[model samples]
Target: MLKKLLIACLLLSLIIAGGLVWSYQQVKSSLDLPVQTPENVLITVKSGTSFRGLLNHLAEEKIIRPSTWTRWIPRLEPELVRLKTGTYQITPVMTLRDVLALIASGREHQFAITLIEGDRFIDWQTQLTQAPYLKHASKTMSEAEIAKAIGASGIEKLEGYLLPETYHYTAGTSDIELMRRAYQAMMSLLDEAWQTRDQNIPLKSPYEALIMASIIEKETAVDDERGVVSSVFMNRLNKGMRLQTDPTVIYGLGESYDGNIRKRDLRTPTPYNTYTIFGLPPTPIAMPSKASVLAAVKPAESSYYYFVADGKGGHKFSKTLTEHNRAVRDYLRTLSK
Candidate 1:
């Protein structure tokens, strides 16, 4: 009876050891298997999601096969279970271990939206509407309402307030947040430029500089010509000459502009029409880039009071009307050719 009892105890120990080894093998195999995804996919782990909960979510999404071995991951590796809440991308070639490590490392995916220089605020609205993965919080909000939402209170217009650059954000980030960042960035840059501006420039304040920058931004895209274009506008402003810029006239026309600038458009008076107004328009006409902003504050010293497109992707600047007419004729001659 004693020998039989000892043999039974030995068999029981062997069975228990074998079960432990089998469980270890199963868990190891599951962790090593590739995630079952055809292409790269984004997964958002929300706050307060447990390790087991995430595993269940993955299984439901068919990214991972549900198995009993996966249940031991949290217990065996407690550190891996401390998942960070963010959007993560998982690829087909990634193993279960790789996904866990990625999530644990808290490396979230980023998406970008670019606001272009010389583009209108309305253009940015269209871009925000089309940008993927971002929450369209400002879609239904009016410009005034959006300005208020982004903490840009007292700002009558939204144009030229937001900086033109590429902004990066994670999934589910709000458009309002992005706009706020842009506004703050522009404010900071504007302040820095204002502090270091040439004291002799005609701009009375940062706001006026912004308006000039917007005009410069629209006038030229040539890298070396920005300062010279700015100089022409500054000279005109100092001499009490009309800006007579077509962009301002077109801006005043709004939807009435039908691809061509007619004589009647210039004859009409509006707040944005530089030909009609004596000084800078009530606000910036469009978004200005950093270069344009810098050029507005620190223009190149020149006597040029006029400029016309030279048909070579640049402008021909002149100090007198006769020279300007000659340049215009030359531009027309180029067009004729």
Candidate 2:
């Protein structure tokens, strides 16, 4: 009876060892197997997704072969169980093991949103709304609430606060967080420009310089014209003359602007109309480039106080209204020709 019991115990041990080796081989095969995708595919691992759940999803998508052995992989490599929530790219060249490693590493694909110079805040909002995988938390909030959420409290206007640049972010990033980064970037550069500004500039504060920059951004797209345009506005400010810029009038018109600046529109009174107001508008009209901001603080030395489109995709600057009127006449003549 004792011999029989010993033989039975040995047989049980051999069976257990053989089962363990088979399980190990199955797990290794599952890990080494390539994902079944013929092309690159994007997969979103939502928050609170379990490792088993992710594997089940991959099997459902036909991205990987279904197997019970995959359960042992996470047990052996504990890090694979901590799935990171993000959008990941799975390619045909990737194995099931590679996909697991990528998800575990939390290296999600990056996306970019470009906020263009001279574009309005409304335009940026539109872009944010259309951006994929980004949480649209700002959609439910008011503009004031958004400003506060982004830690921009006490700001009268949200426009011109954010720097215009291509911002990169991973999936699940909030719109407010993106905006906050842009605002911080703008503040950093604005602060630097303000501190190193020419002391003789007529602008009182950095905000005022930003306001001037916004105006310059609207006036021209020519890189070389920014400094001269800054001089024109600065000279006007120093001489106590009304800015009389048509862009200000158009901005005040808002949705009512019929794509043309009429004589009546210029004469109309609005808070944003520089023709009616004595100084800078209450807030910036649009986002300005860093070059425009720099030009505002360091204006060229000139007596010029007037400028008009020269009919050649550029402007004609003049020191006197008489010269400006002549330039306008020449511009009109060119248009007729």
Per-model TM-score, in order, reads 0.90, 0.84
Which candidate leads the pack in TM-score?
1
lDDT of 2 by residue, 162-192 (tens): 8999999988899999999998988998999
Global lDDT of model 1:
0.92
lDDT of 2 at 63: 100
| Candidate 1: residue 41 Cα off by (Å) | 1.1
- In candidate 1, residue 335 scores what lDDT? 100
Task: Provide the clashing-pair count of each candidate structure.
Answer: 0, 0
Q: Any idea how many clashes model 1 has?
A: 0
Cα-based lDDT at residue 15, candidate 1: 100
Model 2 alpha-carbon drift over 4 Å, by segment: 1-40, 67-72, 75-81
